[model samples]
Target: MSGNIASLRKEFFQLKKDLLSSILSVGISLILFPFLLGMENSLKGPIFSYIEAFIMYAIFSLPYLILIGVPVHIVSRVATKNMKTYKWVTSFFLHVIPALLIGYFLFKNTLFFLGSTVVISVIFFSVGYLLNSIGASKRQKLIIALLPFILWLLILIPTILTETTNKALMNEPNPEVEVLVNETSFKPRPSFCWNSDGSAGCFEDKEPFLLPIDPIGEEIQTNGDVTVKVLLHNTERSYTIEAYYFDEENSIQKVTGDPHSFTLPQHIQEQAVKVIATMDSSKKGSFFIPIRTGNR
Candidate 1:
């Protein structure tokens, strides 16, 4: 009877771990995938639309599930299995891999990277503790549950305050180009909408915004010659570059799938490379980049 009870308890523990792992996997996958939430609004057409959207989401979200969710679930299982043999190892893998991937790909900001580390660490720690803290007192369990949230507040509150202060100190939007910073976390890319008012047709409520996301005029490559290879994203590419590129010899070419070449006037110390973009041939605005001519 005692042996049977032990076997039953082991089965229940394994079940709990699997259930929790699955729930966490799905939740984090959704967060990582980002576009998963926009499906409801995107699929309002016919019954066919609903089925299509469901198929699309499953296809799109599968990679995130494998990349982020599976790794996290594996590490969590390791930690829960013994919590002694490889506790720190499990936590390190859980925290570092995802944080590094997110920070490196998304933004190279050090603060953001550190914040990711702290937030994920606290989460894993709290969850691990709570799972094993069944023998602890109520107060201990409560503290374990609330500690991660408190730590996150401490990190984010300062960032919020600093951003607000900086914006207040220097409040100026470029009168020409219309830029939109998406409040939606799902698709975390800034977009330039056709409209400057930040209202209709800007937030991509209609169709996916397909414009080059990177800021313009950041020409890269050499000192002798400047070459800007447009990393053409299916999601974005700067049409503005195609319009206003000219050389000292009056030679020009549109920015295409390859790195388009342009020449600055010889002997001129500096000149502004004028860039203009038009949507539906409406007069949008022109942007200028001042390039200096020198080996220095």
Candidate 2:
């Protein structure tokens, strides 16, 4: 009876260890996923912003990780335990397929969703396997646990430096140019939607919502060509400028560069001119500047 009790306690401790390992693996993979996605877009932000976003995404995805990721991870670990020769093959089926199915429900693009799941599953399995490897030292396990964060910093630091350098070069004074408005803001929107048919869909808006321009006066008076700069943060896409007065289209200008400038019409008194930054046909952002004719 004592022997059976000792064996049961041993089994219980081993189970606890496995569960903790699975949670760590899944949590690391979840945290790394957004950074991986950001890499496709050149990780276009500061390191701190990326960290902040990671924290926010982790917070929001915690429940999903607990509900789906932990169970799947444990199941894969258990299913592949006895299959030493075919462990990887078994792990792939057990880990990747279920994750792919979940991704299919959550994402619309077949290739993108499949690719993301495969990457995540690979990370999850690799981390778990490294942690549970026979004869692995505690130091080795610690390294495995921290590998994701190390990899993230390795990639993130250089990207940020390059971006900073480019911005510095762009900021160098040119005698022929003048920057009227330079502002930045954080505005993020949902990238996915759900259809009535229980399928994932792309979230596209016919007209994107307007983001307020701070420190730039909404009312202004200009006697000649009034140059105004506009920028949309955290996007690599180009935006076109459209000017409207009295609810009629005045002029449309396609802007292909960041920190672009546009000239507002002169001699317009107390009438608001709407300047829109249209990124794509599906989305746009705008701000209003009330034009006054008289001088200060």
Candidate 3:
């Protein structure tokens, strides 16, 4: 009876580990893959839209299952097998989920980029922990513990080096071009219809006042440029437009308004504009528009 009970417990523990592994893997894969797709921008055509939708589903849903749900289940199993309290395990996840959500809303696009790295690091540590805890012998346990440390070293050294290099490059200054919009008229209408190109035909709503801007296209060119007009259509609101340019080395310089006329500097033909609109003493709506000088 004693031998049978020990065998049963071992079987149960193994089964629990397998189950947790599967859940964590699938949950992580779903969440991480969508964010990866967005960062890569690899998908094209009609399929791109579908993939984007799927990515949204994965990002919002998978963390609950992987970090909170699977971890809870694993902690219970680990507790039973090792007589260790699972309180910390549960608390860690409870804290992580809220932090992750806060980061998601605040960072948006950037959160996914950073989150992917964090999730991969976690998976690496989890694998090491699992191997070490469940090893069959002392030699196996030693290998498992050392392997993770080695793998982490290999991964982290290059990452740190690259970040340092990027930071050094980022500190370098670049040339700038500026464009200024002279018009300061504010429209009384709170809502206006507009085409996607910010043309006179399209309209915008009150609070999130969508400024119409031209979409970028394939086959980048140097002379293909379009003019966009922005109208602040609220009595209480006023807008200021500023355009800037960067040189070949990506150093920024202002090129417009100081001398009048929207000029794309030769060194900074690919420029971007920021339209800042203030209303009732508070800055309200702001948008960015990109311009490239080229004909395609």
Candidate 4:
């Protein structure tokens, strides 16, 4: 009886360790995959931007990882522990099933979804294999798991310091503009419109009423005269749009327009604009539009 109890306790501990390792694998995959994607596309942004992207991915991914990944990992590890033939292959396929499912639902594009599934499955198998090879040494496994986060911090610290020093030297305050409008007057789409006869009525509110300024291209060139126009659909409520950019001396400058258009400075290398749409003195939403100049 004592032996059986001891065996059960050992199994429980092993399962606990496997669960922890599975979580670490999910974290590492989320952290590293965005960086990999950014590199593949030659994307440039601040360290915190990448971190924010990772956080958004994690929000959508954690549910699937906890619901599907943990159970699958624990079951497959236990099932294949004593198998003599094709154990790793079976484990790889098991992981691939969940990865493919996740990729399909997460991505809408067919080609991109297929490519992402392949990459994600390979990452899953490789991480799983590495963790298995580390045996039951918790300390060693943890260090390997946390290596990506440590590397990210190393990059982030220097970026924060450099930005702080430059801001201090430039003595420039971040440019911003605030305008207030009545929120009660703003008409969002009704939950269900009813006619005089108490019948449901159809309202033509298909598109978004308020939208931020859309740049002509992915990257805007700063060489010649540049003008950005704010597009707002609802003419019923009034909206104020302002454009902000950094000057040659790295000081933020604000440019206000006549309700629709704003002219930007021509000498800046890059323009980072924050478009804030507020109603009733309450902030509704804001978007960051990063425009980079020059040929890559």
Best by lDDT: 2
Q: Mind giving the per-residue lDDT tens digits that candidate 2 earns over 159-236?
A: 678667656534533222112422322222212222322222433233312223432344443565455665455555
What pairs collide in candidate 4?
Answer: none
- Where does model 1 exceed 4 Å of error? 1-5, 8-12, 28-62, 83-98, 101-125, 171-296
Which lDDT tens digits does candidate 1 get at residues 198-288?
2234332211111133423442212444433212133232343333444444455344222222343234323334434433222233334
What is the total number of backbone clashes in candidate 1?
2
Candidate 3 structure quality by residue, lDDT tens digits, 1-296: 99999999988878766575656545555644544434334456446755675677577756754665455445544554544555434433443454456546646777443454334434433442553354247675566445424544554565567667556434423212222222322222122122222333433222211112454432122342333345443242333434344545555544333212344434234544443332322323444444445411
Q: Model 3, 210: alpha-carbon shift in Å?
A: 37
Candidate 1 residue pairs that clash? 211-236, 212-237
Quote model 3's TM-score. 0.26
TM-score of each: 0.37, 0.43, 0.26, 0.41
Per TM-score, the best of the predicted structures is 2
RMSD of 3: 18.0
True lDDT of residue 183, candidate 2:
31
Q: Which stretches of candidate 3 lie over 4 Å from their true place?
A: 1-13, 16-20, 35-43, 46-77, 80-109, 112-236, 239-296
lDDT (C-alpha, whole model) for all candidates:
0.46, 0.56, 0.44, 0.53
The candidate, 1 or 4, that scores higher on TM-score is 4
lDDT of 4: 0.53
Tens-place lDDT per residue, model 4, 1-296, is 99999999988877766866787767766776666344322245557677776777678667766777667776777778777778777876786677667777767465444444445454555566666753447775565455445544554565567557545533422223222111111221112222322222323222212112555444333455566655444323355655556666656667765674676666554545554443222223344444555412
